[model samples]
Target: MAMFVHLTAAANTPRIRRAGIRADSRGQGGVRGVYCFPVLPSYTLTHQWLRELARFGPKGALSAVHVRLADAQEVLVGHYRDRAKDAQQWLTAAEAVARVAAQPDPRGWEVVVPRAIGAREVHRIRAVPQVAGWRYLPGAHGTRPCTCVGCRIRGEYGGRRLRERHPHPLDGPPPPVPVLLARIEAAGDPGDQAALLDALHWFGLRRRGPVDRLARLAAHPDPAVRRELVWAVQGWSTPGVAELLDPLAEDPHPDVREAVADVRELMDEQES
Candidate 1:
């Protein structure tokens, strides 16, 4: 079934122009060459390139292209590869950058300059937070795991098994509860809030820390945040925890209500 879908997708894929290469209508839409790097272009620029690539079928474009620099040319390649729906692509733009600049830094960490190819230029590339000591450099063919002290220790002692080590998190202790709470309170971005909430749940579970503040976030404007909050509150049988969850039964979002139902069922099971 998966093979049929793959073949169907390949057949229906539109072609696009590749960097330093012209469009070949007669050729299969599969990628000819990919320009791999580590950064991504702006959304506007990415959309423009996607529009241009769609002119050709999917087979004619590259499968996975990375842009190290934010240059127009590089961004075009990255966006094209992403939109081409190539199953071969792995790392996100941020991951690609981390892989390229994986060398150890005496100052603690290295930085990548985010210069674009043409008029649009960024001052610096934002650092992608990674697990401690897991430096990876992209090889001539693809990316490989770093054998640094941190990565090595993580492989053995950390949850990462040898086979599952490729996409492991950075080594180092998690941030303090206060720090996470501060970020959650101040975070305006929904994505940031969601991640912090997830981290809080794990941190609380491991340490059995206080989560009273998290319960307050049930009123968060974003339904996604509320849903995550529901998950975070599970297994928390503290005083007033049930009262805090009662109102969520009538939550505006159906998913949130469903999560509340699941939690209620679990609680009933525990009592019985």
Candidate 2:
């Protein structure tokens, strides 16, 4: 996902365009500074929506939230000419809503919305298969409620109270390390490949064998895959992991080089 902030001349002052809205900032030392709002890709926006839902109970009406989100998206589409950018804004808005609905709070914090309206929008978003790696909702499966002490305490408050609880893990065991490794190897799509690498990092590989398997991807054709490979190597302290990373220090891509530097710095910190 690429973020673009456009600066244009307007009358005597410079106007900054971000998220499709223009704002004026005071000139400093005869130079006008451009104000830029961080442009969040659809994936990031969906993640943010999940975080917001987890923190605050979804009390507002769905229509109201939809309108607000739509306005933000319209502004983005207007400013950015890229069709992908426009698609991302719409997809992010819809996916975020669907994720919130799927993970309804049992404690009644989940906002009630017209099922038809919400479902219609979700269906529309899902119909477009162009967006790769679009999952309906993450962590939606499993029936077992969290038995953690925090969950237990939060359960006592009922619908009236809004107490924050750490999200309970789902009931099922995580996918085996080998399965994830194979998925990473088989993934042909850049986005899917990157995501799998990230998941592998999160799941962690205890054995040196899996790390060795992952390190081989450092020579992958795509820079993104190489970068993720570099990231995955940071956690492993195996004997030849340094050997795997050393060649990457001279990688043509700045991002790959930076990742190698980060790993080296972290290794230094650990050794010291």
**Using TM-score as the measure, which candidate wins?**
2
Question: Candidate 1's residue-wise lDDT over 30-50, tens digit each?
Answer: 333232233223322122222
State TM-scores per candidate: 0.34, 0.35
TM-score of predicted model 1?
A: 0.34
Show where candidate 2 strays beyond 4 Å: 1-165, 168-174, 188-195, 203-209
Q: Name the 10 consecutive residues with the lowest summed lDDT in model 2.
A: 106-115
Q: What lDDT would candidate 2 get against the real structure?
A: 0.40
Q: Whole-model lDDT, candidate 1?
A: 0.41
Tens digit of lDDT per residue, candidate 2, span 1-272? Answer: 21222212222121111122222221212122222222233433332323223222222211111212332231211111122322322223344344334543311111111111221121111111112221213332354334432233222334212222323343123467777766776775443665665555544323344656666677776787777677665666567878888888999998889778777865674564
Q: CA RMSD for every model?
A: 18.4, 17.4
Compared with the true structure, all predictions reach lDDT values of 0.41, 0.40
Error of 2 at 246 (Å): 0.8
